[model samples]
Target: MFLNTWSLWEKEPDYNSYLGLAENLDEKGYAVSFGDNPFDDDKVGEKVYMHILNRADKYVHIITPYLILDDGLLMALKYFAERGIDTKLILPGIPDKKAVYALAETYFRTLLNSGVEIYLYTPGFVHAKVFVSDDKKAVVGTINLDYRSLYHHFESGTYLYGAKCITDIEADYQATLSKCEKVTYESIKKEKAFVKLRGRFMRLIAPLL
Candidate 1:
């Protein structure tokens, strides 16, 4: 991770400068995986997410501030739910950015219809970027379920497999879910006309977000 960041700031980063640092460090029992972004040909962060979703057996829980998803991710979430994987997403009810929030709402209909549960935190903003799956794997970091985080920005995340902390992470998600109001098709229909229009406009330029 440090080497990846160094390459960004330095005109020419020497990979050999950090060689052999982990030669004596035992990593056998540790299942923590780290990844960073701005990859030239591959979007590693997005791939990590897709991999988790694809490999999930029982459930997948997510907490993200933004929800502007590309077709691939959108389909992946829907597919998981449709296949009865207990998929759920917790988003903020009190948004820091109304425009982005509106854009995020554009996905609710399709997601809800696909049987993917959607919840809105009613207290304040939810800025958590987390993904916990099947009680055995999880990710906690700066990645958001949007185009900017997945494709444009420099981002990183720690993937945990069979880590003790994953239990706590999933517990937190459950606690947060209690504070959220589930969104149904009826609730989506109650949205103001203006907000829907704004969401439509934002969807067209979602990739730039």
Candidate 2:
């Protein structure tokens, strides 16, 4: 059964609900959040990475128009691979911002090495901020992997457990996979350091950039 595609940000997830997932996971010894504000050091050694990793359920479907592999998210992804999670990352192939695209590549290499599959949505901007784990839970809204979306933007997302919506989200993620290029560690290491540095600089002001 295929569920029709719907816009993520346009759909908009409830703010409190997204944060609730974080708190709930924390109680269960997992910590993840929707927005940035990484002030809770003891609780959140990593940012919203638990949003991706703490799911030992089925699969993790992530849709972010823009993405970067910061330390927090990176560590969570590494953990996901160790546990053999069916990891799928869907990002934008036709990048609107050249610098951000470069930075994403840097993260792509790291993610690929950790056994996390990468997918790039080429139809458009692919700016849907959402994540679904094993069809049981899903988050969709405006959050991203960059520091800005996490630390700045007042983002929102949803966690749905229904059948119709879950199927559609999975289908879209799989569809985008067909359009993505598989990244490798070799390619990442071979990338130009100068370009990578430029991307990092951009990340420094990613919220405003």
Candidate 3:
């Protein structure tokens, strides 16, 4: 089932779709959560994502155009990496927004050091938001890895467990990986001061973005 989150800033905040979807998943014994208000700690997108990430056993593959990781999400990914899980992120090689890309780069070194493999998709821009885990669970929706997405935006994604498309999702992930350029600490460290400052500023105010 497809779920959608429409924020009040963009339209009206309608989380009925997500709430209903979560209910369905819950009945099937799949851990799920959804919230319309970002101010409420428990009823927010990040909480839902954290539950999913924490449940991942073997691998977690994420494909997103943006890569602005919040502290909690970053910690979850770091934990998975430290546990020897295959945690991978596929981002855009040529970004649609340079400022966002720069801000995302600021975390590359830290994430790399934590053992999270990062890939930059070549050929064209990667605009999909997908999460696949351990061949049994997946999430496909509009959740970006930025503070705006996790906090301000009323985003929605389908929480799938043993879905038929799981295999196809993994296949797509591998195919996309083939078109990516692996990111390294050395490559992201040579940025100019002004660029770094701008990125840092963007990262600082990501929630307001």
* Candidate of highest lDDT: 1
C-alpha positional error of residue 97 in candidate 1 after TM-score superposition, expressed in Å: 0.8
**Candidate 3's residue-wise lDDT over 102-140, tens digit each?**
898888888888899999997868989888888977777
Model 1, 1-209: lDDT tens per residue?
22232122112223234564534434421244456667575787887788789888899999999999999999999999999999999999899999999999999999988999999999989999999998877888899999889999888877766557788999999999999999999999999999999999999999999
TM of each candidate vs. truth: 0.86, 0.68, 0.80
Give the runs in model 3 whose Cα sits over 4 Å from its true position: 1-41
Give me the overall lDDT of model 3: 0.76
Give the top-scoring candidate (TM-score): 1
Error of 1 at 171 (Å): 0.6
Model 1 — TM-score against the truth? 0.86
Q: Is candidate 1 or candidate 2 better by TM-score?
A: 1
Deviating ranges (above 4 Å) for candidate 2: 1-52, 185-194, 200-209
The lDDT of model 2 is 0.61
The lDDT per prediction is 0.83, 0.61, 0.76
User: How do the candidates rank by TM-score, highest first?
Assistant: 1, 3, 2
